[model samples]
Target: MREARMSAIGKGLRRRGRLMAQAVSPPRRNPDADPGSGPAPDPSWTAPIAPRLVPSPVFVLSSVRSGSTLLRVLLNSHSRIRAPHEMHLRTLHVRLSRSFSADAMRELDLDRAELEHLLWDRVLHLELTRSGKDVIVDKTPPNTLIWPRLHRCWPDARFVLLLRHPGAVVASLTERRQDPNPAAVRAEVLDYAERLDEARTHLNPHVITYEDLTADPEGVTRGLCDRLGVDWEPAMLDYGAQDHGTFRPQLGDWSETIRSGRVRPARTATPGVELPPRLRELAKAWGYPEEDTPTP
Candidate 1:
């Protein structure tokens, strides 16, 4: 009986010692948490916790291979910017239209347009609040082709056209070797650029040269901040140091953004395929010098 009682005392003392040890040692923090903050935010819940107005939502418009990812990394590094990778908003209407009904929408205090914005705003605001940022920059190149849809859904939204030399863009795409028909790929590139050129007619869209973004990231990003009505932070230039886990891939090519350090100059390449005649005209339209025939 005495031995049994002594064993009970021994177990209680061990339990109390463990409790005291745990109390003495600081609690381990979740790796996902921001230092000094309670917990890391879940991207899905931030919208309802702190609904953002999205008064000045930003879109990064560009043609594929225009160094859009590079621009995304730089701009997203800004203090107030929450630039997630492409959300593929090109078919936002087609997807939303299936469920759109006037009578049903009215019951929820929304019209057709409001319903679309409500659905989109939920996603955008969640992204912003999750990052604890004010500006939401959706970096989707195809979104430029659907300016009309965006303008209708968000009349106050802002745009940044990231332009690169069409020849450079074409060369980059061809090098990727993803698509077979170079001609078709060039047409898609020209189409996106032309749409932005036309979209400028009704909106005060800001243009940023991809060449400038790579060569002079700070100067160009600061100019973008001025246009965006937000203060520029040096942290933007330090994108290499930030966490990009929440960022999504765009058009299956966010791999370019895996660079670890500051921006680099445009990569020089000898493109073998000849650019179409229309591409030369577009080069001129976009302020890039025309190039000669493709090398055999």
Candidate 2:
């Protein structure tokens, strides 16, 4: 009698699990939906084996002011890695001048997005070839926003998730803006935090924290090197010795800290600053304290 009862419970549990999975699953695509009724879908949407020149390029996914530039310069110092300044690949778009231009490309099995992907791939390949480096890392912070598209573009791409304290990020942005709105600044940070969290959830990325990175540069970088399948080079710590291309606005952080050619310690959260409920929750989720504590 006990065995029969246990069997019934197991079946019930399996049924519940299936129902839960169905509830969270994405809605099925409408078979009758017009393809032309919307802005065309990505070319690689259904094609998982898309051709890419640089198949396993690395992307540092982080928010602005999150020390991505510092990471870039550090990685750039590596002999086998070519970490370029902000390559805003997402901003590069392919426009079909004539109405039939897209159709012509379509006949050749390419769409606008696919064309742009080809261009992006070619550019990365060119940079890698020019640098004579085996690996290329694009540390564009904005790339975090369009991660899904990037995944579609290069399915084999690797991701590095860089995180910072929410409160500290807000404080940094507020100080940097010429005329800062407290609410706006907080909202912006929250937006980035949400997206970063989403990307972290979806991608099996190598995660690093600005606090730990600054406190133990060698230790953090050594682990990163392991993840990137490279030997830990002492030169990565001496990023100041490398020529990381031009460091200007729009390209990346051109502050005195980055230009100083050293890893400065990350600042703690502002004492009196109050984070929004969501930001506070996210900060906690990232292992930050509720109080303004210095991160080690």
Candidate 3:
């Protein structure tokens, strides 16, 4: 009778062990089970994690009428890039600095964190959204003069400098009747060119000659892409199809030139532009074609 009781006890223990295993283990489906009869939905169909945003900051520096717009259009063609017409933020910054009191200027220097916060949070954030780009490209020509400050603000920023024949730039500026200071523009161009050369020594900037860009846009643009560490997209060559709308009032008489999507050809420089002698000397030194003097 005792042996019989021991056997019954062992059997009960084994039964309990089996029940516990069934409770902890996942249910196995029958091979012939219905196709749609699953206990839980597959996890693969769930939504994925959000992607991180990219920060692209591209700047084009050049003199007015130096094919800066063309370059901007080309860059804007890139799917990942956003190249907008001159935001003139740097210009505004310069104007603001000039108008600020000495005490205010000191405060700006002392409050670097606050200043950066205002610039990035208030100004650049709005610009990025308005531009509709993963990367923002500022194509302000005069910004070339303030590159040192720009570099300080954005150390990792890349630069594209559009170079044109000094003579052609002078001729184009002179033809505008409303040019505030034609002579001053000429002087500024020369000075800026020199400054650009000097700044180049301090930064690894890419230079794109206007003539080369016009003649072989694809090759030049490809080269620029390589230098800028961006992929070369064919769309960039046909960016003129996009409309840029009306030019800004601050563009002055050059507004007409900006509206017209024409790239003027470089030819022999003509006289009567009244470029200062020093500027003329710099133009010659820069190897610009000789001016075509009209017969007296």
Candidate 4:
């Protein structure tokens, strides 16, 4: 019994000694670190770092099916330019702003300044991906509806407004049934066009018509480049081959057609496609000749 008691006491002493040694010794450094190294601090442990600032992107606003895609493709052909499909960033801002006005949304921590900063950060991140490019174009179609907000967001950023005959626009919309809500699309287009005109009075944005773009893409693009201070690139005309894999999937099969690298006239003389009379009248108002109107 005495021997067993002594053995227990010896084990206890060894354990106590180990405890004392552990308490006195400094903690071991990370095995991956050098012997003298201390804790490796996180690169972002100080604060959330903001992305490097870039110039605000040029915004193209226009009605759907109005050659905005063609312009975007053409502009993107320039080695110095990166044009992506309709990002609808301005629309997001509008929705966020509206959300903040609701009392129920008060607790969501959303506000104008926060939303603006968030959008700025998002845009900056996008710009960084196109780093080294001279210009980035946001080719959002519905962005035409929020021109004022876009102008306010980037006062110095250039705006390119694409004009199509409302008749052509309405005809295209009716044929494609692209707008799920026809009434809403009609109202939105009319309101957006009027608002665009109003905004131009104050902002003096560059306006290019679909007719001009289709007739002389290179010339119009050159002029646009001059106005926007970008160099004219022949690649813009052949931009159909460029990959647009990053655009949102909801954009439809149009991108696939654009990828085929064709810049045919917008109004093809397809046989047997009869356009309704109302659409013909609408097209006429927008300067499309009644006789040459492509069948729907």
RMSD of each: 14.1, 22.0, 21.2, 11.7
The best candidate in terms of TM-score: 2
lDDT of 2 by residue, 205-272 (tens): 99999989999999999999999999989999899988988889999999999999989999988777
Against the true structure, what is each candidate's TM-score? 0.72, 0.82, 0.63, 0.63
Identify the leading candidate in terms of lDDT: 2
Taken over the whole model, the C-alpha lDDT of each candidate is: 0.71, 0.87, 0.63, 0.65
Cα displacement (Å) at residue 152, model 2: 0.9
Output the TM-score of candidate 3: 0.63
After superposition, the stretches of candidate 3 with alpha carbons farther than 4 Å from their true spots are: 1-56, 91-122, 130-132, 179-182, 251-268, 271-296
Which regions of candidate 4 fall more than 4 Å away from where they truly are?
A: 1-52, 91-111, 178-185, 246-249, 252-257, 268-296
Q: Which is the winner by lDDT between candidate 1 and candidate 2?
A: 2
Number of backbone-clashing residue pairs for each candidate, in the order shown: 0, 0, 0, 4
Give the winner by TM-score: 1 or 2. Answer: 2
Over 118-203, each residue of candidate 3 has an lDDT whose tens digit, in order, gives 45424555766777766677787777888886665565778877777666677766655374676577676778777666666677
Model 4, poorest ten-residue lDDT window?
Answer: 43-52
lDDT of 2 at 33: 47
Stretches of candidate 2 exceeding 4 Å from the true structure: 1-49, 293-296
Q: Alpha carbon lDDT of residue 110, candidate 4?
A: 41
Candidate 1 vs candidate 3, TM-score winner: 1
Candidate 1 lDDT tens digits, 39-122: 332334221112326766888778887877777777778777887777876555412232224445445555544555666777
